[model samples]
Target: MRSPTLARRERHDLCDLALVLGEDAPTLCGEWTAKELVAHLLVREHSPLGALGIAVETFARLTDRAMARLGRRDFAVLVEQLREPGLTPYALWPVEVLGNTLEYLVHHEDLRRAQTDWQPRENTPADDDAIWTAIRIGGRALVRPAGVPVRIRRADTGKEVTLRGGAEPVTIIGSPTEVTLFLFGRRQLHDVTFEGPTEKVAALRRAALGF
Candidate 1:
């Protein structure tokens, strides 16, 4: 039997936590509760029109409606469906690993980090490499709007990637997992540190940092 992909592990873990935390538990997806977050995931996988809206702002209303519809289901039902989804692209191993790994990673933390007693979970080197790969590929898009030179460094490996380029590049330093969170807009909750010009760092504080 094939071992589960990172995405599957994250997905299954998130589903487990969501069930334990219940539907109304807080999440980092703005004001969304666990139910809302799960609904969004379901819609992203199952609703053709809403899926487009997941990343595109123009179709947000459609996604909202779809989520609202899904949100009406029992919380356990929603999570179970996500864990054992039928015919969803995320169920396919390749797509699950490539497309959903980082997505679920961030969302898992979205739920995890919201609790008061939350603690940082250590990521293995393999998982760090997986997330680092995602940062190398997708980090550019999330950092581009900042408009300043941006570089991310993995603290342990000393490996680096440039996300956006310009003068006085800001170097974000941390484990890949923390860097991923910071890049994905969970700036305050991340363990990452930065090295850059005072002005550039200040500008980054004010700028929109992620997708």
Candidate 2:
């Protein structure tokens, strides 16, 4: 299956999980309820103003205002809206596959891992491959902000990426999905092994790491 199809399936699974967990359930996204997360997703994919808000500081306030309004609506209603196909401008296609695959995957984990007893989801080989591809394409940029050299190694495939060049280097080892989650600033929640000087590792951990 293609990345977009996988992402779409993940979106549906997220809605289903949101229903099962209830709208008010906590998520890794600080202070955001499941309903709020759904609203963000909706705004991101369907609202041009909201999408612009993501990059342009001038539009951020507007996006936040939109999200606040959307959050007030019924939770199930919001989920249903997400389940429907997105607006034509934002429909899943060429870029959607690459852009949304990691997005939906990470957000899905955000909701699941926020729970006390949650375990890592069992992903298929295809899911693993897709996520690895995402990492190859975008992961370097995500970690570049850390200002320290870093290496990410996939325990399963031995695939690796040196994200930056610096005097001090840190290595993070995990499955592709776990590495993806870590790169997305979910380090505390993601189970991965870190090998490096204590100070360097601490710096890497403290540095903002994400899109």
lDDT of each: 0.86, 0.83
Which whole-number lDDT from 0 to 100 does residue 45 have in model 1? 88
List pairs with backbone clashes in candidate 1.
none
* Residue-level lDDT tens digits of model 1 in 149-205: 999999998998988877789998998888888888885455778999988877776
Best by TM-score: 1
**Shift in Å, residue 62, candidate 2:** 1.0
TM-score of 2: 0.91
Model 1: number of clashes?
Answer: 0
Tens digits of lDDT, candidate 2, 31-135: 998988998898887778887887688788878988999988999999999975556544647666777888888899889988888987778888888888888
Candidate 1 matches the true fold with a TM-score of 0.95
Deviation in Å, model 2, residue 116 alpha carbon: 1.4
